[model samples]
Target: MPLLWKTSILLAISHDSNILPAHLQPLPSRGGHIRWNWIGDEHLNKTTDIIYMNASVAADGTLTGVSDFRATKFNGVTWLKTHAGREGVFAFKGPKAFMSIPGIVLPQDLKTFTFEASYAPQGAQNAELIRSGDFRIAWKGDTLSIQNGANTYQGSIPAVPAGQWVQLGCVVKEGIPSLFVNGKAVALLPGQSQPLTSIGNATLIGSGYTGMMDELRVWKEARPATRLGRDISPTWADRLLYFHLPADTKRSMGEDKASWASQIAWIRSRLRNPADHMVRLGIAGGAWKDMLRDPKARQKFAGEIASIVNRYKLDGVDLDFEWIEGPYKGDPPARQWDNYADLAQRIRKAQPDMCFTISLHVVCYRMPKKGIDAVDYFTFQNYGPSSARYPFDDFTRSLAAFRKQGFPDSKIMLSVPFQGTGDAKADSVRLYSDIVAQHPNLPPTADTAEFTYPDGTKRKMTFNGPATIRKKCEYAKAQKLRGIMYWDMGGDVRTDARKGQTDYRHPKALLPVINEILKGRR
Candidate 1:
């Protein structure tokens, strides 16, 4: 429930018995009240296992929690009532609604435990998502920050438009704290041997939380990153159909709801392979953009991605952390790669079967073997203004360069754009289906095409037609690359008014060609 995108649905969906890890095999079903390991049972009354709210309120105003806890949603707080079939939903009225649990303060001798919850942020107004006086998670306008007494840190997670959700968890052992969001470990504060100072007041979910919450779990153990209750998800098979989505918060580009969420959902539910389930619908972009250079920022963003996949139940995650040195080159580029490696390592530990992927930007394309080791697959873009990977411009060079650099072609998915381009290597930039619609006479040869935008300006562009795509696919097969990929899901097709999504209009579009070439081959 904590958006454990690390989820397997825990059902016998696949016939392949050997694929699941030992922990994921067919198991007993336990309701929400399993007493995980309460070594402090003798001190039950002395112990402060208070439950403010376990992400849900029953029809009788009861919380589905463990023994020795009763969550009371005090002061006339209303439920969101739109839970999407989850375990719990708590809706707060800014500044008015707050839940508290008393006796959680540990005795001076205690030093280990876990705190976790699934929370969604719905606005910019200052409010605490969850906090004790000694530790707090809050949103100050567009940014999210955490505090432990006077020392505070902001998470690298990007700002979401009014209604986006994420999970947060923290494990404090001997006073050293490791924080997590959406199942990925984010930060480990310094001073492990010190005592965990208490919050003078009590454990509270107050200040300003304007969204639903669920699966509130706590454990009295020094749980390792691996045991962080990361729900497992299904795996992508040899054939991968991935989309690089921008975590576009504001829904820009004349779009409505988060780009392609509904579309991808449509694909997952509507389109299945008959043998396996549907495609392993994944997302990229957002949170990882500025994470390449800072340690805490990297940790914060790592959890952000994990949280997203968990919240959305994506099959996995794909990354595009582009800046190696970035503007001014102030940060060490090598360390940036290390941060990402840590991310993959931590998240994979929680959800080993989930597919993890990384993208290689052409200009500065180079990854340590370990970083590559962290992921299930590696993809390199061959299209851009550089005119390097585009078949219309010249397809041979980019693949050859990757080979020349000793890359494992078996792991590399040669990524291509599904749209046409112009300018000093790139421009006209319209969907492949749109290109066909505009010029019925446009041939499959690598020829220059003209595009007229709403501005009434025309630009000559080099387009990858059906013939070129087929050739590229054949070339990839001959070279034994992983597979061919388009830049995104929306770039190949035109928007459909009926479903408020896009439709595959032309059979000759490169997308169709890729699917055609890969059909039954894997």
Candidate 2:
């Protein structure tokens, strides 16, 4: 892999060894020897140029040590080392050093470039083995692509056998770049036309390059290839066309409803047409039941729910009542289920346009068939099946069974456990303040009774760091799942509070990852 343009600072050290002390012998007959040392004074002599050893000089004349040995010169004090060698004689012990060429040509502005090249496997670690610019072309699986702006480029080549290499090259000229795989042109696009600027920094090798790259080159002038490279192939464009559903806020409970409503409002405010994005509000079925017990409370709750729906302009409401001590328990409570159904009917009558979703435990699948038909969408809390000694596969199959029973994919939201503990006790409710004080690692536990690992590792794990969460969101998009809904927002907010204690402020770490996932999906 080679960057489309290369920039570097090359330092040429020259020394003639006749001025050495006669008694001071060279070590082990090395090819050449030069010794230079510097000390400081009360004040530096501005007239004397500072000598740097194994340092990369920045644009400001500041010497940045690229090697382990480095010190600064203050007043008259200095740190310097001797250099001895002809063009390529002395063995260099550190990174290659370079000197910036003032007023050199620049090929492109600071804009990012995406090039298309044949996907070639870069082996296990996917290290870049080719001599390219700061960038190297390497493959991870079977394919690779470079993306920038509105353009994307991709290429394919004969699969390289293990221990073999593949040749891939791309060059930009006149607002267009051509990609060559095995010396044949495969893709091309209008490369942003710009001046050929001097690459003033050391080439970062294998940093951005993923796969294997060899024989990489960059030229001030564009060279013609035997084949014409085109834009991202139609196949690649088709792959990018896929898309994620709106996030479901069904499990947001108590104060969580307000937080979720705020989140939805925040998202809604940014959209040109809020209706374009799906918004699901959570209606506490427990609250509704409490209202039934107290008629006055029912009226107040109904008014509050209606106000919330109007205030947030919600698209739908997800009925999430755990039904912990309801009549539906022990034996089928047709009356209790009827009350719940009637509440849904009332809300639907009030907001005819709004969608209604009912969240149920997997056991709800055993409810009378008519009870299941009342809600517009069915959300299955697929978590916690392990409590019954049921395999995760079994839980997944139960959700699949709903689909088999005429539930549309769009009408189903899978509720994943935010609390990753396979242990039921781990999900035991804790106040936000308590979590802030104790700072227990919560959820997505790697090992615990609440969480069971595929490989049987028993380590408790939190949801993966932000990077892993972003990857999971991407996977969700790829899988075309309806959307992801977690049990509650308080736990996550509390986790951030604990982190904020040490840092003096709550970190916006999770927001960025979430926003990235929501990009364009809005």
TM-score of each: 0.48, 0.34
For 294-385, candidate 2 gives per-residue lDDT tens digits of: 33443444444455557655545554565534463243455555555555555555566765556667665433345445555555665542
Give the number of colliding residue pairs in candidate 1: 14
Q: Each candidate: what lDDT? A: 0.45, 0.33
**Model 1 Cα lDDT, one tens digit per residue, 86-198:** 43356566766666644332222335656665666566557675565466666667555655555555555546555556766666676556677667766443322223356
Top-scoring candidate (lDDT): 1
Best by TM-score: 1
Worst 10 residues of 2 by lDDT: 2-11
Model 1 scores what on Cα lDDT? 0.45
In model 1, the Cα lDDT at residue 218 comes to: 50
